[model samples]
Target chain A: MLHAPASPQADLQSEPNDFSAILAEQTDRLLAQHVTPACLKAADGGVFPAAAWEAVSDAWLPLALVPEAAGGVGLDAPAAAQILRRSGYHALPAPLAETMLGLALWSAAGGAAVEGPVSLATGLLRLASGTILAEGTMAHVPWAGAAGHVLAIAEAPDGARHLALLPRAAYTIVPRRNLANEPRETLHIGTAPLGPDALLPLPAPLAGPDGLMLFGAFARAQQMAGAMERCLDLAVAYANERKQFGKPIGRFQAVQQMLAVAAGESAAAGAAAQVAAAAWNTDQFPLAVAIAKARCGEAAGKVAEICHQVHGAMGFTQEHVLHFITRRLWAWRDECGNDAHWQERIGRMVCAQGGAALWPRLVALRAAANGDRGTQP
Target chain B: MPDMRFATVAFPKDAEDLRLQVRRFLEAEKADGRFVPHRSSWNTFDPDFSRRAAKAGYVGLTLPEAYGGHARSSLARFVATEEMLAAGAPCGAHWIADRQSAPQILRHGTQVARDHIIPRICAGECYFGIGMSEPDSGSDLAAVRSKAVRGAGGWVLNGQKIWTTNAHRVHYLLALVRTGDAGADRHGGLTQFIIDMAAPGISVRPIHDLSGNHEFNEVFFTDHFVADDFVVGEVGDGWSMVTQELAFERSGPDRFMSDYRLLTELVDRIGPAPDARQAVETGRLVAHMGALMAMSGSVAALLDRDIVPNVEAALVKDVGTAFERDIPEVARRLVAVEASLDAQDDRFAEALADVALRAPSFTLRGGTREILRGVIARGLGLR
Candidate 1:
C-alpha cells in the first residue's frame, strides 16, 4: 500500500500539461486545517497566527522545495502557487508564502533550506550591484518579520540574477510602519556579507519580469478580497446602525443597491483571482496571471473606494476598523505588480501574440476569467 | 475550503476530476439511452432518468450521509449541474426537490417533510415545483394573491401560480400561500406548504414556450388542502427563506451554460485547421469561460464555508446568464448560417436558434436583469 510517488521525467513534462487538481487538493487541505479562525492583525506582527503557520507546515506547504529529491512536498512552481492561493483565501499571512519562495530559490541553487526557517524577498526592484534599494523595504512584507530567514532576489554584481538570503540575525531591524498598521519592519543591510547558508545554486534568473507582474497581480487581488470583506462588514454594520432621514439606510433601495454592487465587485475580483490562481497552478501561464492580477487589482481599488463612499463619514474615522482596512487596500494595490504594471505586461503579450489573433485570445481570457478552463459547455 | 469570498477559486478546475466520476456515472445513462440531455435542466421531466440519477446518488447532494445524500461539496454539485446542463440530462423529476424544496424542507419543513421527502428526492423518484408567481404578480413576488385559510385538517389554499414549471409532473409543490395579510411589509404572514399535486382541487394546464414545447404550466389551486405539518420554517419567514433560495438558484453553472451547445459547435466548426481569427475568437471565449468557472467555484467554496454569499452568488448568476447568452451571439458572429426556426441536425445551429429565442428571458427568469443589476450595484456600494 505504501509506494514511492512516481518521478517525473523532465522531457515528459509536456506529456501532461496539468497540475491544477493536485494543486487544488493540496490547497484544499491547507485551508481545511492549517489556517486559523482569525487573522493576524497588521500590528500582531502582520503575520498569521503561529498555529496557522504550523498548520501549513503540517500540510507540508513549506516543503515546496521543488528541486529537493528528499525535501518536503516535492511540488513544482505551479503546485506551490495553488497552495499559496488557498492560503490567501484564508488570509494565511505571508510567512508561509515567503518560506516556499525561499525554499524554491535555495533548491534551484542546490542548497537545502527547507529543513529550517527561511524567508524570501518579493517585488524586488534591483538597484545597482544587488545592494537593493526597494520600496518593499524588507518588513512591510505580507508576513515578513516572522519568517526565520529572508532571501532577497536581486541582480548580482556579474549582471546575472542571484537569490541572496539575508539571515534573521544579519541586519539591524527598523520599527514596523505601514498604512494598514499591519506588522512590517525595515532592515538596514549596509554591505553585509552574502553568507553561504543563505545562497541557492541557480545561475539564471529564478523568476522573470512576468513573474513579478503576475505575482503582484495575484497578491493585489487577494488583498482586494480582504478589503471587500471589510467593505461588506462596514456597510452591513452601518446600515444596521446609521439612520438617515429617519430610517435605517439599509431600508432605502439606493443604499441597499450600493452595498450590493460592492458585493458584486468583490465577486468579480475574487473571480479574477481564482482564474489566475488555477491557471498559474496548472499551466504556469504568465499571461493569465498578468490579466487576472490586473483586473483584480484595478477592480479591487475601485470596490474599496466605493465601499468607503457607501459608509459615508463614519468610514473615514481613525477609530473605526475601516481606516485600518482601507489603508491596507491603498498600499496593497500598489504592492504586487500594480495595475499599470500588469496592463503593460498584457499589452506586450497581446502585441507579441499578434494583433490578428490577440483579440480572440483576450476574449478567451475573459471567458477563462472565472476558472472555467473549458471544463464544460 | 479557502473561502470563495476572499479567494478567486474556479469550480471545474477544483471539482472536475471528481466531476468526471459523476460525469461517467451520468454518461453511462446517456450511453444506455436511459436519459437524454434535458431541454431545461431544472424543469424538464423524465421520471426514469430521475430514478436513475437518484440511484446514482445525485439528488439531495448536500444532505448528511445518514439522510442518503453523498455529502458532496457545493462545488461538486456545481460541476455536476454544468455537466448535466451541457449533456442536457433530463433531471426534472428531482430537480426542484434537489435544488430548493428539499433544502428548504431540511432547514425549515417539519421532520416529516425532511424524513419522507428528502430520501425520496435523493432516490430520484419524487419531484417538486415552486408555487410562486401569480398572473399579475410578475417580479415583485410579495404581491402574491394566493390565500391560505386555516381549516380543520390543516390549511386550505386558493390561488393560481403561473410559470409553475413541471407542475403537472412533480409530486409536490412548495406553495407560498398567504396565511394572513401583513400589509406594506408584505413579506409577512406567508407560509410555505408542501401541496400534493395529486390532491383534489388542483388543476394544471401546460404552457407552451417559444420553442413550441410544453415545459412550464399554469397551476390553479382551489381549496387545495395541506397539512399543518407541511408548513415550512416559521410563518412569515417565507420571504427571507425564499430570498435565501435565490442564492441556490442563481449561483450555479446553469446560469451561463444554457447555450453551451453553441460553444461546442463553434469549436467543432473550427476544427484542427483553424485560421488565426477562429483560433483567437475561440480562445477568447474559452478563456472567459475559465474565469467564469473560477468565479462559480468560489461561490461553491462559499457554500462549503456556510456563508450565504448572496451578493457574490447573485454576481455569478447575472454574469453567467450574460455569458451563456453571449455564446450564441459570439458564435453567430463567428459562423455563417441562415438563422431559422426549428433546430436542424447540427446541434450548434439548433442551440444558436434556441438561445436567440430564449436569451431574452434569461435574465427575466428567477430575477430580471434590472433587478439583478440593482442587487450588484447595491453590493458594490454604487447604488
Candidate 2:
C-alpha cells in the first residue's frame, strides 16, 4: 500500500505571505477529516491508511522543511514544526516527521528531491573510496521497510563525513513497532552497494552526532508537545462529560486540579517546542534543542500521568483515543535521546562553563537567536 | 485539541539596551555598598533602593510619560524586572504600585483618582497594598464582608483586612468593600476604593511572618471616610476589575523569580566543577527557569497588546510559583549546610534559610494554588 510515490502535481503549497496560519489550518483540517476514531482503530491492526498518506502528500506536508529553491514549499523552521506538531496532535500513524527531516537533509547533501517517504538512521554506514558500505545493524529506523529510500550519515576512514541515500533494495529490513503500534523497523545493511552519486559529503553543522540527535530530539519534542495537548484535551472533555456520584467529574475540585496541572505541563512543553523550533537554524541550536527536548520529554511523562489519572479506567482502554496519544507520547519521549540524556548534556555544558558564566551564556544565546532576523517574532 | 496560545516573543532590541542600563546601575549600586546582593529580593522592603531605581527610571515602566513614567513597552519592563529579581534588588517598596495598582488606576480608576495617585506612585514616593483578602475571605475574595455605606462624603467603610502586605508602610490601600447585595452571581455589589492609610478611624497592626519580618499586617477600619473621587471605576464593578488586575499581578518575572537568589547561590556554591548529581539537578532548574521566562515574556507581550490573558496568567502563576517553591527544596538537597538567617559569611546558607522560610508563601500569595488551578480548569472548559 505504501509502494507508490506521490505525484508532482499534488503540490498544495499555501501562499508565501501567510503560509504558517494557512498551513496550520489545512493540517488541522486534514487530520480532523482523516484521522477519526475508526481510522485510528483500523490502523491499530497494522493496516497502513493509503488514503491518509495520499491526503497528507496532497497537502505537501512532507516537503515543508525543504527550501523553496530545492523544489519544496520552503516554510521556516517554526512553520514546518507546526505541521509536525499538528500531525502529532492527530497521532499521525506514519513517518511524517522523519520524512520531512529526511528530505531536508537529503537535499542539503546535494541530492535531488525524492518523492516517497525517507527514513533516517545515524552512524550506521561508512564511505570508502566511491562506494557506500553499511557498518552495522541500524535499529529502530522508523518506517524503514515502507520508505522508498533510507538516508544514513556515514563517516569515512579518514574521519570525513558523508550522507548516503540507500534505496530499498540496498538493505534488508526487519519490521518492528513502537508503543503506539507505529512501524519502527530495523535495517540490516551489511556491505550494501551504493553508486558514487548516492554518497555526498555531509555539511559542517549536520555532520556531527550532536547535530543529528538535536534535530531528531527537537522533532520528537514538537510531537510530544502536540500529543500532550491532545491528552489534556481528552482528559478535560472526559472530565466534563463523565459522571461520578451524580455529578460531572469535572465538578470535583480534585479532577479540576489534576487537569489544571496537565494544562500547565502542556503549555510548558508547547513553549519549549516553540523556543527550539524558532532557534532551529541559529547558532544556538544545540542548547535550544537540548532544553526543548529535555523539558518536553519531562512534561510528556507528567502530563500523561495526570491525564490518565483524570481519565480513570476509561482512558486505559484501547477503545478510547486517549491512549493513542499517550502511547505515542511515551514512545516519543524515549526516542532520539530521552530527557535524562539531554539533561546530562546540558548539565555538562553548564557546569563546564561554571556558575557565573551561565547567565552570560543564556544572554548570548538569546542574542544569537535574535540576530537571525529572518525568523524573529 | 485544546487551543493553547503562548506565542513566543522576542524581547525588542531596545529592551536589550535597557537591560544593559539596568545591569550597569545594579553593578554600580553593589559597588558603592548601597545594597548587598543575596540579602534582598522583591519581597525585601527597601524604600531607599526603590527611590534610587525610580530615579533611574526603572519604576512604573509601562505607564505613560504624562504619568511620571518612561512610556516603555511591557517587554522593556519585563527585562528590567528580570534584572531586578536576578540581582535580588529590594523592590518591594515600589513593586505593588508599579506592578498592578498604578496600572489599575490608569486603566479603570476615576480620573480624579488617577491624577491624585499615579504620579506619586511612579515617583516611588507612594506605595499601595491589596485589600481583597479579609479575615474571613482568603482565596474566596467574593466572601469579603467589608461593608461600605453611602454616607456624607463618599463611603463609610467598616471591616478588617488580614495579610495585607505593606499595609503598615504603604500610603494607601486598594480595598474591596461590599456596598450592596451580591445578586445571584456572588460577584456584584462589591466596590474598590483607594483609602488613605492615614485616614481617621483606620488602624494597622503588624503581623510578623515566620522569618521574623513584619511585612504583612491586619488593617482595621471603623467608619473610615473615603472621598468620592478615590473610588476606582464604577461601584459594583470591583470583582471584574480585581480579576483583571490579577492577570497583571499573577504572571510576571516576580512570581517565579522570588527565590532566584537561592538558585544563584547554589550555582556559586557548586563552583566551577560539580558532580553529576549537582549538574543534573541544577541543569533541570535552569531549563525550567528558561521555559518560565519564555512563558512570562509571552504574557508580557499580551499585556502590551492590551489583552487580558487571564488563563495564561493563571498558568504562569501556577507553574512559576511551583518552580519557586522547588528551588529551596532542591538547593538544600544539593548542599550540606545548616540554613541560618544570620550566616553573614555564608550567603548560600543565608539565602537558603530565607527561601526555606519564604517558599511556603509563594503559592499562597497573589492567589492560592487551589484558586489558580480552579481558574485554569474553568478556562480549559472543564468546569
Candidate 3:
C-alpha cells in the first residue's frame, strides 16, 4: 500500500522550524575545527577523543534532536541529518548521530535527560506484567563501550514495542570496531533487569516495525553522503597536486573523467540523503529512507573506488587521510541495512504495487515531500 | 568540498496541484487509444498527439503569455514533461521546441523570429531540430566547419550537420555556424541562426538506426540563406547561448526517464512476488531513479532562479543516462525472455527490445557521459 500523506494535524505536530541556518553553520564550523585528523587517529587507536566529544557536548549537539518541550533543542530530522553528514565528513570518532537519535528517542518516550554519551541497540524483550526482561544480543551497537547509557527498542511477544533506557553497566559489552576503526561494539544482555520507569511507550512513528532501523538507515545515508563529499574533496585536491608525466594528473581526461564520476556520485548521495531527511515523520519516511540507504550505499562503493583510484597508491596507505573518510564510508554502507537489503525492500514494495502504479506512487512520494517545509531551497 | 551540490528541491504546491490534471489528460488519451503506451517512447513522433497535448496546455510552458505560452513555472513543466514521458507519450514532434528551442528563441531570437515561431510552437504547428552537431564536430562543437557569409539580405550558410534528430520533419533548424575568425579560444567565431528547413540549398539524408528507425538524419547545406531577422543573439556569441541552452536540455526529466516505460513493464512482468535477485535489482534501479529525479528536479529549480547550473546539469545527464542504460540490462537479467520487437504478444519483451536498441543514444544524445563528466570535472576545478 502506498504511504498516504499525513493529516494536517499530524504535520503540525512536528517542529515546523526544524532546520535552522545558524545551527547548521555552527555545527559545520565545530566539526571542521575540532574533529581534525589527529583527533580521528586518536579515536582510531581506541582512545576517546575527549576534547572533540566535550566540544560537541558543550554545543549540545547530542541533545539537538530532542524535542524543545522536553527541555532540549528541537532540531528536526532534516537539521539532524545535516549534522550527521558533517560528523561523517570529519570521520569524528564519537557517536554523535547515534547519541542525538538515542536522546531524541529517549526524550520522546518521556525519559529524563541523561548526560554523557548514549548508544543505540535494537532487539527483542519479554514484557510480563510490569517487568521488562531483555535477554537477546544486540550486535554492532555503536560506541557501546564509550557510552554511559544504552537506548534500546525491543519488540515484545504480544506485539507491543517498548523503549528501554538501560545504564551501560547493566549489559555486558564486547568491544568491536568497524573498518574505520570506530567503536561498533556488541552488547550481550542476560536477563537485564529494567526498572519500572526504564520502560516507556514509544512515539507513534517508532511504534511500528523497523522504526529505529528506518532512522538508522537514514542516518547512515547522511553519513555516507558526507563521507563521499570528503572523499571527492581529497581526490580532486590530490589530482590537481599530483604530477604525472610532468603534468598534473587532473589534466588527463581519464583522471578528470574518474573524478567527474565521483562528483556525480557524491551529488546523487547528497540529494538522496537530503530528500530522506526531509521526509522524516511523514508517511514517505520508509520509502524515502529506503531509497536513500540503497542509493547512498551504492554511491558510497563507487565513490570510494573512484576517489581511491584517483589518489593512486597514496590513498591506500594509512599515512594518507583519505582512508579516514573512505573507511567510514565502507563501514556505514554496511550498516543500517546495506544496499541489497534496502533495495530488495524497496523493490518488493514497488513490485507489489505493480508497474501501472509505480508512476503515481513515485509522484505521490514527491508530492508528500514537497508539501513539507525542509525541502525548500 | 567540490562545490558540486544538488540543492534540495521540492515541487511547489502549484506544480503538485497540476499533477492530477496532467494524469487525467494522459489517461483520457490512453482510453481514447490516442497512442499505445507500450509501443511509444518520448521519441515517438506523432503530430496529432502533439497537437492534442498542446491544446491541453502542456506545450510552451514557462514561456511568456505574449508568445502564446501559459507562463508556468519550470517545476510545472518538469511535472508535465515527466508525466508525458512516464506515459510513453509520443512527444517527439513538440519535444525540442517546447523543451529548449522555444525558450532559446524567446530569450535570444529576433522579434520577428519569436513573434512568428513561438506561437506556432505553442500551437504545435511548428517544430525544431538542433543543428549544432556536424560531421566533424561531435564532442568538439567548437570545431564546427559550417559557416555563414554576408548575403543579399542576410547570411548565406554552407555546411553539413549530422545526427540532427527530426531534421526532415522539423520546420526549422537552430544551426550553429561560423561567421568570423576563429580567435585563440576557437569559440569566438560561432553564431546561431534559425534556419527555415523549407528554404532552398538544403537536403536531409536519413541515417537509419540499428532498430531500422529513421529519427537520425544527416543534413547538407549549400548556401542556405538565413535572413537577418532569424539570427539568435549577437554574432560570435553562439557558444554561450548554446551552453546556456544545454542546462535546460540536459537537466530535465527527458535525461533520465527515456527508458522509464521499460522499467514499468519489467516490474509488472516480474509480478507481485519477485525472487530475491529480481527484487534487489529492480529496487536498485528504482532507488537510482528516485535520486535522479531529485537531482534533475533540483536543476529545474535552479534554472527557474536563472542560475545556470551547467555542472549540475552535466551530472544529471551523466548519472541519469547511466540509469536509463541500466534498465534494459537489469530487465533482461531478471526475466527469461528474448528481447525482440516482433514479440507483439509480450509487452515487456517488446519494451525491453525497444529500450535495448535505443539505450546507447540516451547517453550519446544531449551529451555523452564522458563529455558530461569532463564538464563536471571542470566544475570541480580539475580542468
Candidate 4:
C-alpha cells in the first residue's frame, strides 16, 4: 500500500496568523534580489535558469502547496497563490507556479511527495486495463522537458477518474515556448505503464475535468494581476522620468490620462484576482473564478497596450525591461483559457438560469460562499 | 510605484442580514405590483414608492437616529442600495436627498438646517438637486460666474444652473456660487447655499433628454434669497465641500448599475445554451461588471471609515461608467433586436433602446470622462 505522509491540514489550521502576507513579502524579497535583467535575458535566449530554480526550491516554494507533515511548508491556496503572484511580478523565467500546483495536485491525490520539479499536462488522459494512454497530443504542457514527472487527470473505462503520474520519458517532448519565453512544450504520450502507486483515484471534489481548467484559470488570473501591477509601476516611473515637452511627460494631461487608465485596469484586475483567490476553498468551484480569469485576461490586454503606448518607441525595443512583465501578461491571459472562452461559460450559466433568476443566483452564489442565507430580491 | 490602496472589505454579518430583509421588502413590492420593472432604474420617479420605502425604514439609512435615521453602517446602506437598483425600484424621488443631501446637511449644515430638513428628507417628503453645473462652466466647476452678494441678513444669489436632475421637482438646490474673487489659487472664494426652489426670483425650465424624459432641468436665479442658516459648511469653503460631495456621488453602485436592467434583459433574450459568440460577449460584460462591483464596494468601505477617497472614487466612476456604456453595445451585437422605446412586447428591444439613449449620459453626468481621468492622474501624483 502506498501510504501517504501525514497531511499538512492540521498544521495550517493551527497557525492563526495571516501566512499569505508573510509569504507574499518573502517571495517579493526573493525575486527582487535574484531575478535580474541578466537572468531574464539568458532565459529569453532559451537558456534555462537552473540556479534561479535552485534558489526558489531552496526557499521551499515547490513544497508551498503541500502539508507540512508531507515535508511541505503547509501554505494554503491563497498563500501559495500569493507566491505565484510575486513570481509573475518578477517575470521569473522558471516553472515555479507549475511545480507548486503539480506537487499539490499530486499530494492531494494521495501520491507520495516527490523531489524533482513537476509539470501538468493540459488535458485529461485515458485509463484502460490498469494502463494510462493519452487520447491526443497534450498541447502546451508547461516545462515538460525539465520536469521529472507530468501529472494529469485521467478517466477510466468505468468512468472513474484518477490522477495519473507519468515519468517524463513516457512521452515524447516537442519543445515550444510562449511569448514570455517560458517552456510550453507538447507531450506525445503513447501507451505508458503506470504502476498502482502512480495512480490514485481523483478526489471527489475535483472529479470533473473542469477542475483542472478552473485551477489553471485561477492561477493565471493571479499571475496576470501581479504582472499588471508591474506594468503600471514601470509606466508611471517612465512617465515621471522621461520629458518630451521640456517638463516630465507626466505633466502632460494625455500621458497622465493613459497612465490613469492603466492604473484603473490594474486595480480592477487585482481586485478580481483577490475575489477569485478567496473562493479557492469552495466546493462549487464558484463562478467568481470564471469572472476573475475573464476580467483579468481582458484587463491584461488593455494594460499592456496602454503601458506600451505610454512608454513610446523605447518600450517597443528589447533594451527595456517592461517587456519582461508585459510579455508574461500576454502569455498568461491566453494560457489557461482566453477571455472569450471563460466569458462564454459565464454567459451560458447566467442565461440558462433565466433573467428573473439572474440576480438571485448571483446573490445566492455569494451568500453560499460567505455562509449567509440567500436573499430573495 | 507606490502601492494603490484597495483593500478587500468583508461585510459584517449584520450587513449581509440586512440584504435578506431588503430583498424581502422588494419581493413584497413586486408581489403587490407596485410598479413595473421599468428601464429608467433610479431615474424612475414614483413618489408613492419612495414614501412606501421610507415608511419601511429604507430611507436615510446612514444618517443619525437624532435625525430620524437608522444610522446603519455604510456597508448596510450599500447592500440595501444595490438591492434597490437590482430590483429596478422607483427610488428616484428620494435618491438624491437620501444619498447626498441628507449626509451633507448632517456634516455641514447648521443646527437649524439639520433640524428642519433632515427629518423631512428621512421621511421622504423632501427632495434636493445638485446645483453645480452652469451654461458656461460644465466640467470647469471653478470657473463659475454665479455670484452671491451679502444682503441685509443673508445672501442674494444670481446664477443659472443647467442639467440639474429633478431640479423642477425637488424642493431645494444646494447651489455653489462665487462669493468672493478668484484668488491666486482659483479654488477659494466659493460658497454653498441651500436655496428654496419655490422662493421668489427662482424659475425652473424643464430640459427633456433625448429619450423625451423630463428628468433634467435648467434653473435660473436672479435674486434668490438664502438665509444665513442655509449656508453649508464655512463660507468660502464651497470648493472643497463640493469636491467632497462628488466623491460621494461618483463612488456608489449607481455609476455601474445604471444599465443593469439591459443586461438582465439581454440574458433573457439569449436564453440558456447561448452560442459561442453570445456566450463569449455576455461573459466578457459580466466579468467587467464583477470587477466594477468589487471596486465600488471597496469605495463604500473607505467612505464608511470617513476617509474621503477622491481618487479612488473617480477611478470607479470612470471605469464604471465605461462599463455601463458597453452593455448596450455588447447586447446589440449578441442578438439582433431593433431598438425602440415603444416596442411594447419586445422587452429586450425596449431595454436596448432605452439604454442606448441613456448610455451617452453615463459618462457625461456627475463628471465627464476627461475630468475623471484628470482627477485620477492627480491622485496618481502624475500632475
Task: Report the CAPRI category for model 4.
Answer: medium
Error of 2 at A201 (Å): 3.1
Q: After superposition, how far is residue A96 of candidate 2 from its true place, in Å?
A: 0.8
Best candidate per lDDT, number?
A: 3
Distance from true location, Cα of A351 in model 4, Å: 1.1
Per-residue C-alpha lDDT of model 2 across residues A40-80, encoded as one tens digit per residue: 88787788877888888888888776766777766667677
Per-model CA lDDT versus the true structure? 0.63, 0.83, 0.85, 0.82
- What candidate 4 gets wrong by more than 4 Å, as runs, is A1-23, A68-71, A131-136, A190-192, A283-286, A364-377
> Model 1 over residues B324-353: C-alpha lDDT tens digits?
777777778878876565455665566567
Which candidate wins on TM-score? Answer: 3
lDDT (Cα, tens digit) per residue for candidate 2, span B1-383: 34555866667788999999999999899889988777888988889888889989999888889889989998899889988888888899989998888988898888888888888888888999999998899999999999999988798999999999999899998889999999999999999899899879899999999878998999999999898888888999999999989998998989898988788789888877888888788878887877887788889888888889999999999999999999998888989999999998999999998888898999999999999999999999977
| Cα-based lDDT at residue B316, candidate 2 | 96
Model 2, B94: alpha-carbon shift in Å?
A: 0.3
Q: Which residue runs of candidate 1 sit more than 4 Å off their true CA positions?
A: A1-263, A274-291, A294-377, B1-18, B32-43, B64-76, B272-284, B340-345, B373-383
lDDT of 3 at B71: 94
* Superposition error at B326 for model 2 (Å): 1.3
Winning candidate number (DockQ): 3
Model-by-model DockQ, in order:
0.11, 0.51, 0.67, 0.56
**Residue clash pairs of candidate 3:** none
Q: After superposition, how far is residue B367 of candidate 1 from its true place, in Å?
A: 2.4
Query: What is the per-residue lDDT of model 1 for residues A156-245, given as tens digits with 9 covering 90 to 100?
Result: 556565556666655556766555554456665555555555544433344666433344445456546545565666666777678889
Cα displacement (Å) at residue B287, model 2? 1.8
Could you give candidate 3's per-residue lDDT for residues A191-281 as a string of tens digits?
7567777888877767656667776887789889988988988888899999989999999999998888888888888988888877876
Better-scoring candidate (DockQ), 1 or 4: 4
